[model samples]
Target: MSAPASPQELRKLIAASSWTGPTAGVLDGYQQANLAVVPRDLAFDFLLYCNRNPKPCPVVAVTDPGDPVIRLGRTEADLRTTLPRYRVWQRGELVAEPTDITAYWRDDSVGFLLGCSHTWEGPLRTAGVPVPHAADSMAPPVYVTDRPTHPAGRLSGPLVVSMRALPGHLVARAVEVTARYPTGHGAPVHIGDPAGLGIADLSTPDFGPPPRLEPGTVPMFWACGVTPQLVLPNSGAEYVITHYAGHMFIFDHHVDETP
Candidate 1:
């Protein structure tokens, strides 16, 4: 891994296929995002769902149906092929994972840009908090909680979270630091006792590797951007498109501008 590139450079790298993995550290100072594409007919309800659940879905931009360019973010950005990868869903089932979605682009589809937690890592680091996974060059563990989200017109399901272990004494500081970035998932929803949140075992996260808890450290959970993507299937949408895993849409706005 090398120093992160600027949003514009990272976009070029992704466009050139030089990088095709999780974008956790690719554009350090820029805002990274989750993608959600839905037909125009369902756009209003979906936007309402995001507004109702801002923690899990902070809206950064919403493209006009049929427009591939999101005017709010990088003026020249193209949603179809800017990310390293994308997942395509049809009628609530994941039908394909594609590098590009040019073929699936529809004039009636609207693109939604949502805020992601990656934006808060810098604040944590600046506060002298340790982000073990990013420090060790690894991905953090993520899980689906039994905690159901507020429903809105076919959009409802359990919340999903990403787990990170912090030294017992530093956990409180971590929460405070992250809380300052409300648009980037402010504060943790659950701390300690994963089982209390309906999580079965720390060894088996729904996505990514099992967490490696350090001695005297406890597990901390934060609402994740993935919650919306995971719950979309149950939302009854006939089709949905989202970035695969950590592959995010790099935005032109600064992290503080996310809200």
Candidate 2:
């Protein structure tokens, strides 16, 4: 099915557990975010991690400790129920995948809204780049790379990336257009072989389905916000909640406002 008429409408379906699919191509023109909720005590360090590693964890908006409502200028979203699905991690071990996180919301929790690469796909399409996966319900493929992130206090992990196969001809143009939205992961991190990034096989990814490459297309990789999911587990945080793979929280902001 096509994406909802607006982000708000799509979010309502997600809130009610009616739609639990990826938000990759949904609600075009608006920015989408990866959700990460950690204890208030770990907030500053996590924020530092994001700052040091901005490529994969660009900051969109962060909520005050104990505040579920995210306010960015005029738009607001609830951290507890805005995403399509959530993953609960307890001391580095994944414990649950829930549709709504109300029971798990803690007074000490701080929610983070990190930029997702999907935020820029619509802009890329508008610029004449073919981002085939962006118009479907499927989430782009994600993989864990050998690249290490600059760690901060109590957090460390390798980089994670999302990939999309683009026509060889438009690769340069795709790079130029996507670079304009740094908040949406900016540009491709790898333009050719996946082996350089230590990916053994394109058919198998840590998240999402295997990509279908068309003739004359090249697989492009981008630093992904999902990197924190890998880090949170490695850091062994007491408890954390994050959006499931491919699923995201939609934000009202447009790409035009990004620097």
Best by lDDT: 2
- Residue 88's lDDT within candidate 2 is 96
lDDT, candidate 1, 113-203, per-residue tens: 8878888888788789877777655778999999988888877888888999888888989989888776677889999999988998999
Q: Which stretches of candidate 1 lie over 4 Å from their true place?
A: 1-4, 73-75, 257-259
Candidate 2 minimal-lDDT segment of 10 residues: 250-259
Q: Which stretches of candidate 2 lie over 4 Å from their true place?
A: 1-3, 16-20
Q: What is the Å distance of residue 73 in model 1 from its true position?
A: 5.7
Cα TM-score per model: 0.92, 0.91
Please name the candidate that would achieve the greatest TM-score relative to the true structure: 1
TM-score, candidate number 1: 0.92
* Total backbone clashes of candidate 1, pairs 3 or more residues apart or in separate chains: 0
